[model samples]
Target: MPEFDDLRDEPFEPEVLSSEIAFAGAVWDVRDDRVRYGDGEIRRQYVAHTGAVAILALDADGRVLLIQQYRHPIRHRDWELPAGLLDVAGEEPVEAARRELAEEADLVAAHWEPLVSSWTTPGGNDEAIHVFLATGISTAPAAHAREDEEADIRVEWVPLDAAVRAVLDGRMRNGILSIGVLAAAQRLRDRG
Candidate 1:
């Protein structure tokens, strides 16, 4: 049996007693919160994220779609997988992933599978990101109009081998992108 099978059992979850907005930002909000831990109460400041999704879109030739977009916080453009926030009201994570794929790459997939779920920075934020693997790709019927920083994004398709190299060589440093590409590659390898 896999180690993950043990994780199926429910675990104790800390209950938040009170929370207040410390700072509200365009992308994420900071909150000052108090929670009941195992046997004690604690107060901490953390980011209350809206969560997000990332897509590892693989074409017929095993090339993965990547995007170079300006990240204002880091003050640099990064090569990353197609992704977006789950900020839309009543939208599912997979739905957000599909929307982001269309909006970012203008591509659609006939097949979709869950790849990984992770907390981008659990120590300081509640930002959880779910990644997906999308294959059997084609152009979307209608491309979404980009705005703000999204308008300046550049899209490219790089072979999987090259992407792995980039990840191994520290060139692809985006957390989500690095996680998605490596997991997708490992999944493909495991399938063979």
Candidate 2:
């Protein structure tokens, strides 16, 4: 007999009854899963989410621009690159990137590189995130931020080697940043 985690012999099938926004400011959904793992079993699941986007702003000094913000879920300040949601209606991805760069870091760039695209968490809701590299940057002014954000916005000019090391050391937790850094390095190496 194969070991099964089902201690309770509950016999049931999953059926999505109704997915309704019991509250505001969230994507609410109810889903059902009919398991066919050598047997007929089912389960119901509910999920809700708010999607977002992330932008990687690269400068001429071979350093990546990042933002230090307090993430409520983690309950600590995280050093992540500038990012925002594709929340604007009828806005292109590039436009969303530019807006996020200006809004979060007050920086602008002359060159835009199509780096990569990702779904933050595809297993649940439809939350997709787009990543880009903005090179040849210059200083500007931040237009938007939360009113109560305990933010100390400092732009760290980290070299590629240092960035990779940060990832190894567990300092850089943002997956997009690591991906961006590796891509930038490859781009540089290819130029040689």
Candidate 3:
């Protein structure tokens, strides 16, 4: 009998028979791969992502920073945490989170601690996102220029509990936002 005391994801890599790009986009690409599995072979396709980072910026008053941006796929301008892709070569995830916080919210944080890491859609994509808890926040020295959907981003600060409520009520639908807020809230409870 195997012990069931600990539950965690185990990494496994199967033998790849063939792999190729099924679709190439500006940011991500769809990868088609044939792998040997259980005495047989299977073909699968998924988005090959560069990964991303999200920051849950919390102020002294317990308010969380959020930004509303237009997401074309969903066709809704949904509220989301400060997040961006890890597209820059040689840049660390924490640095990417810091840059995103500054760029999206025009803010800087004195303290940053990792909250959680998740795979957005393990079945459809290989996108892994790292969420960080940012406290001791202040305005950035300079604001970054925005373009496209980010040009009209709306920034707001909501109480941490209220943000969690929004997530539970389905008013907030961004996966990263939902995960970050809930994880931050749980972290607070654990600390208290």
Candidate 4:
């Protein structure tokens, strides 16, 4: 075996010969691009997104807040963190997390710490998610009106350990939820 340097993702921007919006959807757009590689040109199409934020709201009892919403693409009401797109122009990521927590869970958090960030699906989309560990939790003063899929969201608070188990047991499959729960669990262990 040979020793190696630090393993990390490097930024490489190949020359784009041509780029176009193949489809324009209500929330996101699909982009088709022709890029010049080292020896040849390659064409790729992916979803161009505005990114998003998620919150892992932990209460004093060591439980994490989760929401169940219907995902048309997956055709399942998956359990997930309180999350929302960064579609609001000029809104900061943490602020988006705060707003999402209130809108989805009807909760507000006083203390927040950045837990982790991840690219949802690098091979097919440019959507990145920033997850925060929100503590000092309380009910929001005003409730937000829901619509469509969000109108019937099921909110639950489960123990942090139980959430980790669900992720490991293949019960909870949301990408953001898995990342946030694992990161928060590790952070808590490291703190103790």
**lDDT tens string, model 3, 1-192?**
999889799999999999999999999999999999999999999999999999999999999999998999999999999999999999999999999999998999999999999999999999999999999999999989999999999999999999999999999988999999999999999999
The TM-score, computed over Cα atoms with residue i paired to residue i, of candidate 1 is 0.90
CA lDDT of each candidate?
0.92, 0.68, 0.96, 0.96
Worst 10 residues of 3 by lDDT: 1-10
Tens-place lDDT per residue, model 1, 69-110, is: 999889989999999899999999888999999999899999
Higher-TM-score candidate among 2 and 4?
4
What is the TM-score of each predicted model, taking all chains together? Answer: 0.90, 0.72, 0.96, 0.96
Off by over 4 Å in 1: 1-10, 38-40
Q: What lDDT score is found at residue 85 in candidate 3?
A: 100
Clashing pairs in 1: none
Error of 2 at 164 (Å): 1.7
Q: Write the per-residue lDDT of candidate 2 for residues 1-192, one digit (tens) a residue.
A: 887776753555445334454445443444444444434444434345445566777666777776677777789777777877767778888888888788777777788877777666556555667778788887765555644563456657677677867876888887667776777677778889
* Candidate 2 backbone overlaps, count: 0
Off by over 4 Å in 2: 1-23, 26-51, 141-146
